[model samples]
Target: MSKLCLVTGANGHLGNTLVRALLAEGYRVRAGVRDTSDTEPFAGLDCQRVYVELLDEAALDRALDGVEVLFQVAAAFRHWSADPEADIITPNVQGTRLVLQAAARAGVERVVYVSSVAAVGHDGSALDETSWNEEVENPYYRSKILSERVAWEAAQALGLWMVSVLPSAMVGPNASRLTDTMGFLESIRQRQVPLAPDFHFNFVDVRDVAQGLIRAAQSGRAGQRYILANERSSSFADLLRAINAVSPGYRQPARAPRWLLMCVAWLQEAQAGLGGRPARLTRSQVRLFQGVRQEYDTGKARRELGFQPRPSDAVLREAFAYLWRRADQ
Candidate 1:
């Protein structure tokens, strides 16, 4: 009999991709989702479905029963929220702790935690596994940082074997829905962005990141973090060029001054505070990425897990093409 694997948040973009990858590897998969009605992502995929409420200890314990590997891929992923502590922090930090504790009790052999580059610091230098983002004002980033810390603490106390995989700006095709990264590219393609901020971003294929997670489960050292990202970073202008190359006729937004962009973000936040729609651009986001390049070294994952990501341009082009096709449909 093959080893059983339980993937939380199997409905998410990365989670679904990881499910497919695990299935390809001939592992018995148990998909943990909040809403069983959201079944499109699992269509035609042979896997057991379980309701997973990370905050609920009983549900997690039931889901983790007989699972050899537990992939903790669920988290509150958002840049801005009305109540940060309630909406983001508690679920992530508390949920991670509960999940790990349940896994330990269920006798799960290994765990692969899905962390984000948001938890990793970028100080205009090439970041590696050792870099930590301690000065985070963004609620979502702080949640990830705290949650990963909690996961590590639980693993140490419970003597659970755990590895964390940090992925940067994931993009690719076959996403069940328009993810935030894909939505950003769609905004660019649809000319929804009137002005582009001077920011550099790292892109990685979602499939590659899924593969990296599987590799980490197979070969990564316990108590280690692996970065699943492109080695080089791409400027905002470079992203515009890639979008144009993939789909013509959409004009790129003019580069805006940092001060002007900051003011706009402030107004957007104010509007959101007034009980309006959530702000598309937040002051925290502007402060985080303005004129900053997000780059990382994947050598650790490469050397240890044999991880190799596709080129950023290729990933971007394919992502935009998928967006264009979705728009046309």
Candidate 2:
């Protein structure tokens, strides 16, 4: 039988790219989405799509029926939820359990779990697969770490084959409704971005991430986690310069002291707690900005998976073009 792969979050940024790459690899596609009606991207392809919420067991079965590989990418992404732990725990942690259990029961050949680098711990030095990020101060990171553990546990208990791909701050252009990198770009464009953080981050194009998922499904060893990142690390300032290069009139942000920002973060968190409207700084947002100098080594993925990432400038050019066109509309 031909490989029938089910990609959850099929309409999402990376998920859409994964589906296309799977088709190119000659696998029959089954999109696991919240609504089958939204499969516009796959309209011309002879693919199966099922409306399935991650936590809905009945819906999961309908989506997973006869699937050989499962690509679990759907997860709650926002760091601050009105309910914090509750927002992340059930959908991300519990939903993953549901997918893995169903895959085990259905005898799926392998599962590729799409995890984020946010879940990976940042040691004081360069972090790799072996390093565990200890200071997971937010619900999103907490949920991802817990969810990854559930996946590994399920792999051991059910003898299921699984691999986790941790992608860094993704940089690419696509049809995703999610803000992701675009949110950062918009802040820079509108000159609303704060003074550059001291932190550094690796970025990969969505295409590279999609191809990495395909490679993981084919050649990845079970029960292993791989860090997928581009070689160069870009600071928030570098990102701004890239934007200014493309979008005329973009001004560099004034430098704000980190300690001052921390104070703003505290007040923002307090306001959110009081059911006030959104603020510029919050605990989650500040924690996000804390790791300005951290770097990641993608040597493992490059050596093992033959993963080669495009240059940061190329990624910036593509993202800027996409964003500009959209902003014009």
Candidate 3:
């Protein structure tokens, strides 16, 4: 009998791809999702489906029963929410704590926690697994930083064999819905973005991240963190050029001035506060990425896990092609 694995948030972009990856490796998979009704992502996939709410301890325990490995990939990934603490922080920090506790109770052998680059601090230099982001203005970033710490704490206290994988802006195929990264690309392709912001983003393929997670589960040292990101960061303009090369007729917007961008972001936030939809651009996002270089050192993953990531241009092109196909359909 193959080892049983349970993947939380199996309907998410990275989670679904990881489920497919695990299935391809011949492991028995149990996909934990919020709603079984939204089965489009799992269509035709041979796997057990279970409803998983991170905050629900009984549900998580039921899902983890007899599982050899647990992949805790669910998190409230929102930059702007009407209520940041309740909507973003509680679900992420408290939810992670509950899931790990339940996994401990269920006697799961190993766990792979999905963290983000947001947890890693950048100080205009290339960051590695050792760096930590102590201060962040964005609620999403704060949640990740705190949640990762909680995961580590749980692992130590419960003597659980757990490893954390930090991935950068994940881009590639197998996305059932438009993620923030994919949506950003679509906005560029449809010419919705009038001016490209002066920001740099570290891009990584979601498939590679999935592979990294598996590798971590197989050989990663317990309590260690692995960063799944490109060696160098790509500017917003670089992303635009990659999209233009793959899909023609979309002009690259010029870089917007920092002051002007901040002013626009402030106005958008004010509008969102006045019973409008969440702002597409927020001050926290602007402050987080404006003129900042998002670079990382992935040598640890390559050397330890034998992880290899695709080029940013290739990732972007494939992502745009996938988006184009989805739009046409």
Candidate 4:
């Protein structure tokens, strides 16, 4: 019998790509999302649609029944929040616990929790699965770390087989028109980023991340972390040039000074606060740039999980193409 797999957050970028990967692998997939009516993402896919409220224990219990593999991919990721603890931290930390608990109670075989590289915390050098971003004081980053810690704890305590995959900023097919990356790309295409942050991080195709997520479940050691990150770390200038190189009608972005940029970030945060929305440049993002160059080492994943990531350039090119297409309509 085909294994019954439950993938939460199926409506999200990585989640949708992962659902497609699972379907391609011939697993029986149940795509879980917060909204059952928002079916556009999962449209025409061969999978069951299910609604799951992360905090609802009874709802989770009902969803995990007869599920062999659990893909606990749901998490809130806001760049900024007036109340990070209640708005962002609680949802992620509590969601992981509830999913793991429900899976264990349902007697699920194994769980593949989709995590972010934000949990790994970059330090401009090679990073393994053991790397945690404890130094960074950001709500989104904290949420990932705490959630993964909780996942492992519950997994060990409940005797439920669990594996975690930490993917770098995933950019691949079927990107939403309103994601942060897309926003950045649009700004680049429009020359809106007068000066980009000097921050650096790895990027992995959503499809590659999805594939690696499966590989983690198949071969990853329980209680260990696998990073599905890319080999290249591109800077903001590099990104602007690359996007300009691949697309037309894009001017080169000038590098704004650090002090000026910081002031702008402050204004952006204040504006967002007044509007009750997260700013693109949160205090966290600005602070991250002042530190050492951030990057990750995926050597462990390649050696152990047999994972192979594509060139970041190819991913960026595809991203530009996708955005360029979107700009027309």
Which numbered prediction scores highest in TM-score against the true structure? 3
- lDDT string, candidate 4, 87-148, tens digits: 89999999888888899899999899888888888777888888787844888888898998
Q: How many residue pairs clash in each candidate?
A: 0, 5, 0, 0
List the candidate 3 regions with Cα displacement exceeding 4 Å: none
After superposition, the stretches of candidate 4 with alpha carbons farther than 4 Å from their true spots are none
Cα lDDT tens digits for candidate 1, 72-110? 999887777788899899999999999999999999999
Q: What are the candidates' C-alpha RMSDs? A: 1.2, 2.2, 1.0, 1.6
Residue 147 lDDT in candidate 4: 92
Pairs clashing within candidate 1: none
Model 2 weakest lDDT span, ten residues long: 276-285
Scored by CA lDDT, what does every candidate get?
Answer: 0.89, 0.77, 0.89, 0.81
**Model 2: per-residue Cα lDDT at residue 161:** 91
> Residues 75-155, candidate 3, lDDT per residue (tens digit)?
887788778899998899999999999989999999999999899966668899999998668999999999999999988
Lowest summed lDDT window (length 10), candidate 3? 246-255
Candidate 2 Cα lDDT to native: 0.77
State candidate 3's TM-score: 0.98
In candidate 2, what are the lDDT values of residues 1-329, reduced to their tens digit?
67999999888778777888888878898987887787566766667778879888888887888899999988877666667677776789889888888888888999999987776766445778877665466777788888888888878898899999999777665555744455666666666665765556676788899999989888887888888876567777677667767876665566666686788778877787788554445566566656655467788888788888888777776777777777786
